[model samples]
Structure formats: structure tokens, C-alpha cells
Target: MTQKVDTAVVLAAGKGKRLDVFETPKPLLKIGGKSLIVHTLDNLKKAGIKNVFIVIRKGDFVQKRELIDYPLNIEFIEQTSGRRGMLDSMLSLEGKIDKPFYVTVSDLILSHNPYKMFVDCGVAGSADTGALVCFDSRQNKESGANTKVLARDGVIREISSRLPSYNALDLGIYYFSPKAHKSICALAKKDKTISSVPQFFVVYSQKEKIRSVEYSGDAWFDVNIPKTFIRAELYLGEENSAESGESKKERTSLKNLPKTVLLHNKKETVTDITVKRNILERLDEYEVIPSESYNSPHHIIVDESIDSFLGKPILDKLLSLGYKVYKHTVKAGENAKSINSYVKLSEEILNKGIDKKSTIISIGGGSVKDMGGFLASTLYRGIGFISIPTTILSQADAAIALKQGVNGGDGKNLIGSWYAPLKIIVDPATILKLDERWVSDGLAECIKQGFAYDKKLYNLLKGYKGDMKDLDFLESVLKLAIEDKVRTIEEDLHEDKIALVNQYGHEFGHAVEHLSGYAYGHGESVAIGMRVSAELSYILGICDRGVVDAHIELLEKYNLPHQVPKVISPEDILNSLKYNKKYYSGEPRFVLVDKIGSVWRDKTYYTVNCRDEFIKQAVEASYN
Candidate 1:
């Protein structure tokens, strides 16, 4: 029978010397959007463990804020002594843990199944005094450096930080009773020199019967250093895939799936945009293979910042399926969307032998998509391109657009052409890991689209207010935002028609991005830009008072900035607008909204030529 555990002790006091450059405590490091200890605490809570005891060292105050939302009644014990080892950290909570307790390292990440399995295995055998979770040492190439264990039958015979044996690796998770605690205390007192828990476990195994619970699957990761941390993140992607029941062949087949929004040029359909959560897990489900050649290598161009989140999984899955994969990691963010950056990336693609027939998987936010799409369009004149956008800004805006371009210092999207991807895959799960600020930034576009095109979307933004972390709401917002963008793009196809309504606030948004030297992110800039546009329309007596008020009310509701930053003067904004791409010949033109869900169109043009003095008044009013 499996014994129940009510308490858990988490060892988080390890001095992470290797990751000293980060200056962050190892346990406080974020993985899959949550800190490592939070993951551990969450697993403990899910496994029915009620009380949590976390051990830490001095100056470790950051974790207190991280644990504020955790439901468990947690008690933190500080182990101040440097001489103290893993046993000493647990000894700090000796009297508090009276029941059979779970002990785990905070740096360890495991899925819910393994925690339950480990606990069940820990308590079942009559001869077992305690249980230690172990995995095959060969699972990680650097696992040889970790703690090793030797077990015969179900009992762990030897355990060491550096053992030459071929046994499974110690996973640093244990379930021990009060009796075993007494033995550990006695052994720890006798050997005051021992610091690590694994070393102490080695001595304890010599005297007691400690059972081993072997772990299988990609659900566990020991992230102590940078290398392991990266490996663990990639494994997390794999774990997400493992959880999805769809087989590769079944998932890759597009026959019965819901068709995404289709883009059209004149009478011909250009491409489709597909949005789903965890799409990367079953990437093979889509027909990414080039019709011209099945034998050509596939080149994947990913943003360096998203290497762990998307790059690793894409590489692993493609390699496993026997595809020759060539990768080129562009620098992260807007800076990568440059003429110089494009030249470097394009040359790298050619050097890697990626021909026109090769499918290039572009993985990143908007900036990556812009450069990657441009590169694919230029490579051998044109090549197959598939985009996997991982940021909120990218999902809401970039994924829907056909144009890909690098930034010119004088203006945003100054150098580029229209080149649609063969497929656009948006995974909501991947973007959930993005910082909340960027999510809000993406919502600014949603607000902009709602203001110009769809009142339901506008109403959706106004009512049902919640945090940006709300994925369900975000998913709904993205679908509507994409649909609205799709309709506008299909109508205009080339920014020449009513589709120019899509650039509603982008004129000033790009200017703000330039004038502030990008102090305000694209979303924040657009939010402020939309407000300025509303104010400008109101000043011109073209838009309703209600529309202007709605812009203020909705921008505030979303926590988006409506006021221009103090550093940028009205004159600076006016000067910057002259360089904007929306200018007709010499005069600056702005897309004004007549009301929510309607754009102010002047015959053939959706934008009106605005006077400099009027823009100055609007810019000054924006500060208010």
C-alpha cells in the first residue's frame, strides 16, 4: 500500500556558481513562464502535499515575492551556514516535518505524472525505508557530471556525485519518514564534513534500505547550469508534444482540419494563416513539404532569443523524421530586421545549400518573420516559407500581414516587399510564456483593429476586462483580430484600397517608435498613436466625440499608454511624421476613424492629408 505524504521540503540553497553572471538564484530562474520553485511547489500541491518547507541561504529575498500567489502554506527556513550541506538544509526543518514527507530539489522540474508515480513507488514496498527517483544517466550527455546511483533489485546500493558505475542517475527527489530522518540526523552529525544530500544518501544507503523509482519519459529535467537549463527548456517542448495524443502522421494530415483565413491577390489565393495552441508539437501535421522536391533540405531560420522555446523542438522533430535541417539564428527583436542583418542571413541561407525548393521555417516574433520572409522571397528568387510566430505582437499583427521588410533609420518598414508565407502557424501556448507587457503591446493592435473595422471586437475589448495573462480571452482576441486583419487585407490586397484602414495608427506609431529611440515598444507606441489619431480627428471635426472618448476609455482599460512620452516634443513628432511611409508625395496623410468600426474615407482614399499645425495641436493634446 502507498503511504500518504502531507509535507514537502524543497532544497533551494545551492550556490549556483556557474550561472553567477545571471546573479539570479538558481531556483528563482524562470522556465516555461514560472520560476523553478513555483513549478516544484505546484507539483507538490498537485500531488496532494499540503505543507511546503523551502530552504534558502542568506540574501535570498527575491523568492518571497514569487511565492505570494502559491496556495500552499509555505514556511521558509534559511540555512545561514556555508559549511552546511544538503542534509543541513533539510535539518533546518527537522522538527516541523513530523509525517512521511516529500523532499525535492527546487531546481528539478517534472510533470504531474512523475511526482505521483515517485510518491506511490516511495511508499509501497515494506522493506523500503525511503524512495529515491532515478533516471538513466545516458538521457543527458552531461548527466555523467551529476549524481549517480547503483541499485540491485529495488534497493539503492550506492549513491555519489561522481560515481563511475553504469547505474541510473539520482534525480534528487526522495520520500522519507521520521525514522529515516533520525538516521539521517545521526549520520549528518557523525560526518559534519558532508554538505550535499546525495553524498549523505550514499552513506545512508550503506546502512539502510532506500528504494529506487525509475523515471521514464521526457518529463524530468535537472537544471543547475546554463547548459542544463537550455536542455530542460527544450525537453519541456518535447513534453508538451508527448502530452498531445495525436500521432505525427495523423496531426500532419490537413484533410479534416478547419481551414484558416485565406489571403488572396486579385483572383488567386495567396496563402492561409493557421492559429492553434501547441501547433509546434505536431508540426508534421501540416503540408510543409515542397511540392517540387521532397529530397531538398529544410532550412529553419529562428530568432536567437527563442532558440530554447521553438528552435530546439523544430530541430529535434525534423531531425527525428530524417530531414536534413539547416538552422540560421538571427539576433532577437527589431534590430535584426535590418538591411545588414538581412544580407548576413540571406548569405548564410545560400551557404547552407538551401535552394529555392527548400522550406524555410521562420521561428520568432514579428521582426524574425519580416526578415525571414524577405530572405525566402529573395532566395533563388523565391522559396517555400513557413512562419511560427512566438510573440503576442507577432501573432496579432505580423502573422496576418503579407509584407516583410527591414527598418530604415528614417522610417519603419522603409525597405521591404510583399511576400506571403506558404503557411503561418500561431501557437497560443508558446506566446503564453511571453512577458505580460508584450502581450498588452499586442492587444494594442487588437484595439486598433477593433476601432477601425469590427465593433464586436471593439466591444470585446471594452467589456470582459481581465489581465493579459488570461489565455482564453487572448485566444478570442487573436482570432477576431486576425479575422479583421484578413478581411481588410483581402479587400485592399495592396494598401491601395480600403485596406489602408489597417494602418490606422501605424503612421504615428512608427514615428513614436523612431522618436523615442524605441523607448516605447511597438504596442505602447501604437496605443499612444491611436489616441493621438482620435484626438486629431476630433480637432478636425471629422470624428464623433463618442469615438474620441472610446479611444481614451478603451486604451486606459487595457493599461495601454495614451500620452506621448515627455522626452518627445510635439515638434519632434511632426518632424518624424514627414518621414512616415503613409505620406502622399510631400503632404502627410493619416487614417482617421469616423467612429468605432468605421474609418473616415475620402472618396478613393481611406486617409486624409493632414496639415502640420493640426498634427501639432493633436500631439500637444496627447500629453494631456
Candidate 2:
């Protein structure tokens, strides 16, 4: 924004043969009572550009006559060069452009002036700093002649329309530097047939930095396409009506409540990821990670507590690499995962110009990871997600699975969905720095896993007597828990059936955690929930009394709670259970255990209906 360029080149050279229906040249086509070319001029004027160059086919007298009455300085150049692609259009500009200038393909219909946005993004005077305007194609599943950009750190690495697994689509717009125009002509002449603009950029970017700037809003469409022509008409008809109000609505949050979407099953990607070994090593593959924006496929979600600066070290390294980073912090703990929290953070990043092709990296314990996953899944309908589980609770359980959600209204994780992360980074150094209490809070999940599915894992935890501060020792315990967990969660990534065993303690535990106002840590609540599950199992004759005693003995041995605090009544816990996401037909369903190391399943599902009275009794039995 510090520098301003007043000139623009509008490419109107393409023939109207593709639309076959249009007898007029593509730029002469009419929409909303004005010619399409006029709209382009109006947009440029709004962006503060004064000089305009209209590139056309060599002898198009009619196209030139139609625009003769417009006010700006109009120079019509006859483009008589290669393939009629962007390089060919700009080749006609030749010596006329020797300064940084804006360029448009002329067929685009836009709701906002992109020129102003680019000018405001701090334009550089050099040729190599050229920027391309683009949006995440995956958001609307666009298909057509739109150019696809496959990039890293916001730099265009390769560009083409047929690319597989591409993240963004170029909007037929560009900002060319003074040096770039001459260099592009030289490259095009050397290749002879290098007609596509993106092709030129593909080769150009290898030697210099060509950025892909993310832009998304309503109605930025290629008018040359037939369907979009109709869509634009419909857009014009609805332009000033109340029904069309959304056209001007800011595009930061895509929808009101985050819709439940299933992301492509994670490829278990980026296995090379790790933490606390050497921070700088990550720069070898990834440069910039922005939370919830495609322009940044990389970002960090950290706990920004006064005393706890979890991801700061990682953020510092990313900043040093020249990655464009935005910090929108949330307080620590359970209350942090809420509808209000999600809206606040996402809007801040989106307002900061986060594009949909971004990858969001969340750094914290369970709560931050949970909220980060939700933000990643919902922003622009799902971006790449990475988790750095800094605590035992996250590393052992929360980080390994694909479930991502935040608390909704009154229930825990009532509004949520399954979103796979690119990778879940387990940092032993972070674990080494965790408080002993937090270490115990995470070990409880290991015990729950052992009692519900893996008896050997439970026995391993029961027998460990090493100091929690011993990284080598605690990591051994964590490794066993994670391995045992992966064995169950991998087959049922969404926890549709047998994987529901993962929630063995989460049913009552979630409600208890909420009702106690999170006075108890997540694992502590689960420990009590496990005790309740065992007691209910015993009452139902599913397990013997010895099984219940062993559950309490093992939990107490690990320093986790086997009983609920007396301050919270059983009635409050039952009241909160009504909001649990797993309930059906107004009945609270729970995963019951027939014995240690196993989950009791009904005829079909892993959860069973529990009477409120029985649940209350079980809750009381766990009360201290």
C-alpha cells in the first residue's frame, strides 16, 4: 500500500467463438445494463488507476468503437502474437509498460476491486515480487477453464488446470512489475509456444518469488463461461434486493454454525514432522503455516496464557523464515472451546487476509487442539490441519484421532465433526516440561484405554514407578498408550462403531467435567466416569465386584480420581447429560464394560441406554 501504480492492462483479445451464442466480442457482451468492458473500467477507477490499456485483436474496430466514449486514457493495442494466452496479450504491451502495473484478463465479473487490495498489500518495485490473485478451488469444487495453482509458502511452484490435489485457482488477474514484463517477453520468445501466463510463471517462479495472493468473496466469476454468464445475470437482477444482501456480506465466516463435514481421510501425511529436536529443521519442507487460510497452508494454534506461551518458539522460527503470520490468541482451558471463541478467532484471521488454501498448526494441550481442529475443518470448509500435542493427554489420545469439535450451547462437543490432521506431532520436550499433575491427567486416559480395551497397557501403567520428570521413562509409558490407541482408532476413524470404545469414560466424564465447571481435569473426570461405568456394569451384572474394586485400585494408584467431588451433586451431572452428543431418543447412552480390557456391545452399537436413576446411583457411588 506504500506504493501506488496508476496504470492497468485489460486483455480483451479473445474471440467470442467458445460461447458460440455470443455474436458480440466477449468484452462487448452486456450484463446489468452495461457492457462487460465498462464494468472492468469502473472497477479500475474505484481502485484509483487512471491510465488504462485495452489490448485487443489487431483489427477489432467495433470493440474499440464501443469503448471510445468512456472517460479514462484508453490506448487500444492490436495483439498479434502467440496462442492468444496472457503472454501473447502482454507481449503486445511490450515497451509501453516499463513500470509496475495491474493486469486483468477482461472477462472476469467481480464484486470488489482487486487492484486496490493488491495495492494495499505492500507492493514491491521489483519484477520477482509479482503477485497473482487466487482463491481456494476446493471450497466450491469449481470445474472449468480456471487455472489451478499448486504452491508452497504462498509461492507459485507449478501452475496448470489439470493438476491433481490442487488447493487454489487463479482468478485471471495479476500484478506485473516493471522488470517482469520485459523478462516475460524474453522467456516467451525463447520458448516460442509458451502461451499460457501460468506456464510462464511456473518457469519464472523457480528463479524468483511469485506469490499467490488469496482472494474470496461473492461473484468473482469468469464471464466467458456460459453458465457464469447466466449466473451473472441472475446476480444483476438480485443485486439491490434484500434477498441479495449476502452478496456484500464479508466472507470471513462461511456459514452461521460450522457445518459438520468429513474431510478426506487423512493420508497420515508429513510423517517427517517432529518437535523439540531442532526447530529450524522444519524450514527444509514447510515455510509458512497460517491457521485456517489456504493462502497459508501452515499456521500455529497456541495457548496464550500469561504464564504459558506454548507455540511461541515455533512461531519465532516461522517468522524468521519470512512467513506471513497472524497471532489471534485465546485464553487457556475448557471455556476456550465455545461458539463465541471460534467466531472471534476465525474472523480475526480472515480479516487479516487468510486465504482458504492454508494449513493450520495447533500447539497446546487437548483444549487448544480440539478448538484448532474445529477451526481448520470449518474455515472455508476444511484446510490442512497439524497438531503439536504438548501434553500427555493430547499426545496419547486427543492428537491421535480425527474427531474435531468445540462445545456447543450447553453440551460438550455437541457441535463438531471428523477432520483428519496432516500429522499429530508428539514433542517429548513439551512433555518433559509439563507439570506432574498434567502428566497424571494424561496417564488417566492410558488407564482408561487399558481397562476398556488393552489390559496389558493398563498393567504397564500400574507397574511404572519411575519419576514423571524422567523424559526417557514417561515417554516409554506414552508410547505404549499411543500404540494401543492407534490399534483401535485407525479402523474406525470416525468412531462409528467398535471405536466407540475410545469414549469408555467420555460419556459421563464430559457431563461431569461441564457440571463441575471444569474444576476437575479432563482425565480426572474420566477416571470418575470410569468408576461410574464399572459400578453400573457391576449393578447390571456385567462385571463382578472384584472388577469394580480393581478399577478403583488402579485409578487411585495412578493418582487419578476414582470418585466425584462432593461439591457437585449427582443431579447436576445428570442434568448436563441431556446435552451429550451421543444421546438418542432423549436417552443417555453409555459404553459399558463387561470386564476389564473389554467394551460391552449391544446387538449393534457400542453404546447402551442407561436409566437416569441408574446413572444417578452410579454417580453417587463415585462421590467422595
Candidate 3:
């Protein structure tokens, strides 16, 4: 049972010293075509928060009131402390919030489900004392704004305003239950003047409970600087474009895909499964097929069981069309994702007298596609390959992205490439045989895509209630995921600029998977990576804590790991990052969120050149 929260307190009273808005409150600065304070208010309303408390400076009350005219009940309080801090504004709200309440900074633009996050924390008692939203610190350019938390078994032990090193940076957003409110008030009385929320939490944690809730799938922006404001605008434009049903054109110059036919035998299957078969058949008829003289020879790759069901008929059709077909299959599991398997497959292709013009068809999950795609890309200096994804995870997420090599002796996908396939043929009808765990794995990637690219996709997942194993729902998810990936790839065909956003989770993921020795699946490692990246983003001041919490929520909802595995120490993980391909000139560059649907790329906003100690602290904070 989750506790319900109805009230929201937005702390907006800070002097705009950093923003150079000495004439006006910082919250009044424009972001994404709206005032920053109004953006916060609108987000709170969107999260279903009814009552709002806006703490403002004494003189700016008139201007603040003029900025927003809403029907929902709103209270305006003035901070009497001259040139005081966040703690002072929060102290002013003392005793006023009688019910469970959420507190956040006014200068942040967040696309998060705050109501759900608060209610979930309330019900789980995840924050017995109080819950602070923690964001990844690596993505931010600004430091020292994050509050570091240390916890064990869901119970927070210590929260430090001046953490020597930490992972989770406290985003100003908080959920305070009645008990927490009492504790905060008591602390305020004892301290007399409140200066920082992190400091308040540190004092409050000594006496009562203080917990942290990680948020996933939300985009948060702190518009304190000019570049961040620009980023916020760009993000808003992207969001608007997505909402308006704008479709980006796909990239060309790759070899054309071959003609494909869907031959399904009479078997017990759902109507949606049949519909999917019809869709594939229709696509074959409508889309243009490549000329064999110019294109590579098409090979028929299928799972052994699927081959038994539909392979013979398809192979016969291709033969009738004067095309030579080669069949390939591999035993399933992580073992299939090996260079050895790829070598054997390559040898088999050569044995068949296949040349550079021969195409390799990959019909399986991510592992099979990854191995086969790598083989085709590297052999004979690159050949054409098509994906026929059978599993939900592959069809929806993994198949759409570029394929890399399999995990080698050191870790998972330790060796790989950025080779895009000629085409990806998604036959969602095959999702019927997927296990629940596989479906969950697929959702993990889907959730990640939603976090990095589309808020509507995130909302769809948030509202989803059917079992993940349901073929129909999984199929729909696959379509959305594919579209998302295609949009990203089209914008960044060579992954030069925009495509870096797609690597959101891979940075931390690679390190974790390497240290785990490939015990965890790609999706699992990515889930943890997403959380760590979000925390790092907050620490670097690229995004707000609320956005970090939103990212955590998506991961948690899908049963993904929010913390790094205990076996891998922070130092080891930090060491592995140095070798990441994204590292530039001795600095580990990060693709961090500027807002939802928008990412800060290398040489765009700010550079990340922190020392090893800072990196260690960030990794440790993510684990806690």
C-alpha cells in the first residue's frame, strides 16, 4: 500500500545570484516558453497535485502572482529571512502542510509522475522519516548542490550536505509524511535558522527515519544558466514534435532488404498474433524488394522450433524465386553470444561458397542477432544482414539498435561494432512463446528508451497494467520501441551527435556487466546503469533530482536494479569507465539529460573532467 500525498510545496524564494536575476526572482526566468516557477506549478498540477504552496521573496509577490492564474487553490508565503537559503523557505512552510506533502525547488522543469512517486513511497514506508529524490551526479556541470545519502536495507542511515564522495545527489524534491513533518519542525526549532535541506535531513536522520526514492523516466532541468535554458527549449520543441505526431524520415544508402513472406501453419494462436502475421504479409506486398543482381543473396535464418513451424514453406518460396538459401540456427542462451559461434557461422557461410554479396539473416533474440550481425559486418569487410526478431525483448528493443560483438573473456559485449542492419523485420506473432522473465527484460529496455527519448512512451508504460508476457501488449510495446530507435538513428546515422543519447545507460552498464563477469543480462546491467547515470546527471547539475527519481521509478516499476551490485566496488567500476570508447582526450564524456527527450552531448553544454576520487564517490553513491 502506498501512502497518498495531495499537497505540494514549491520553494521559490531564492535570490537569483547564480542566474543574474537580481532584479527578479530566479524562478521567474523564462524556460521552454514559460516562467520557471510556472513550469514547476504546471508539472505539479499534471502530477495530480491539487494544493500548492509557493514560497517567494517579500518584494516579488506581486510579480509572481501575475505570472500564473490558476483555479486550483494556491498559497503564497513570504520568506522573511533576508538573502536566506532553501532551508529558510522550507522552514516557513512548517506546520502549514498538515497532510502528506511533496517539496521541490521552483527553478526546475520536470516531467515526472510526482503523485505516484509520493504515494508509492508513503505506502512502502520507504521514507519513514522523509524521502528525498536522488539524481545521478555525473551529468551535471555544477557540483556541491547535491545532498549525499547513505542507506542500508531501504533505511537511510546518514544524509550529508557535504559528502566527501557520494552517488545519489538529493534533488530538492521531497515527500514528507506526517511523522517527517514533525521531525522537520522539531529540527527547525532546534537550529533556529534553516539553511539547506540536506543539512536538515542530516540532523533529522540522527533522530528518525530518512529514506531515498530513486526516480526514472523523468526529464528535469535546472534553468539557472543560459546554456541549460537553451537546452530546455530544445527539449520542449522535441516533446512538442513528438506530441504532434511528427515522423522523422529514415536514413538511406544501406543495401535494400530482400522480399520476405510470412507462412504460418494452422495452430492455436491469439487474434493479435494473426493480425501481426497479416501486417508482415502486407508489408512484404507494399514495400519494394531489392534486386538480386545488385543486392546480396538472402539467407533464411530461423530458430529450430520456428523453422519446424514455418521455415520449409518460406524456403521453398525463395527457391521458386531462383534464390539460393542457407539455413542457420544456434542453441539459445548467453552462450550463443560468442565470437566462437560467429566464427563457426562464418565458416559455414564460406563452406556454402557465399561471397561478399551474400546476406546473413538473423532470426532469434538479441544474442543471436548480435552474434550474426557482428559476423556479417566484420566478414568480407561487411555484408548485408536482416533481423527477424522472435523474442519480445529482441523485437521491441535490442533488434532496433545497432549490433555489437559478443561478450569476451573480460565481460559481456566486451568486443563489438556499430553495424546497422539492412532492415529489421519484427514478427510480433512470435512473442507468444516468450517467458515472463524475457518479457520483463524487454520492458527494461523499453523503459530506458522512454526515459531517454519519449515522455509519452513513458506515460504509456506507466499506465500499462496487463501482464508483461501478454503477446498483444508486448507487440504494441515493440512497435513504439522500434519507432523510438528509428527516430534516434535517423537523426544520428553515424552516432556522431544526437545518437549519443541512446548510450544513456551503456556507460555504467558496460562497467557493471564487466565486473559481474556476465552473470547479469544486458537489460539488468542497463537498468542499474540508467539509475547511476541519472544520479550522476544531478550531481553535475545537468538535471534536477525530480528527474532522477523519475528515472528510478521506471527501473523499479520494471523490477530492474536501482543500485549497483554489491560484488563490484566503486573503484573497479570507475577504472573500467576510462576505457570506454566515449572517453575523449583523458576525460570520460557523458551523454547526460538536459531535459526529457533531450541530451547534452560532448562539446555542447559542459565538459566532465572530474578526478578519480569524484568518480569513486559517484559510483558509491549510486550503490547506496
Steric collisions counted per model: 5, 14, 37
Decoy 2 TM-score against native = 0.54
TM-score of 1: 0.56
Q: How high is each candidate's TM-score?
A: 0.56, 0.54, 0.53
TM-score winner, 2 or 3: 2
Find the 10 residues in a row with the least total lDDT in model 2.
271-280
Mark the 10 consecutive residues where model 3 has the least summed lDDT.
Answer: 266-275
User: Candidate 2 vs candidate 3: which has greater lDDT?
Assistant: 2
> Candidate 1, residue 117: CA error in Å?
95
lDDT of 1 at 502: 75
Task: Encode model 3's per-residue lDDT on 562-604: one tens digit a residue.
Answer: 7897779887887788767666545565666656665655444
Off by over 4 Å in 1: 1-269
lDDT of 2 by residue, 200-220 (tens): 887888787887666645556
Kindly state the number of residue pairs that clash in model 2: 14
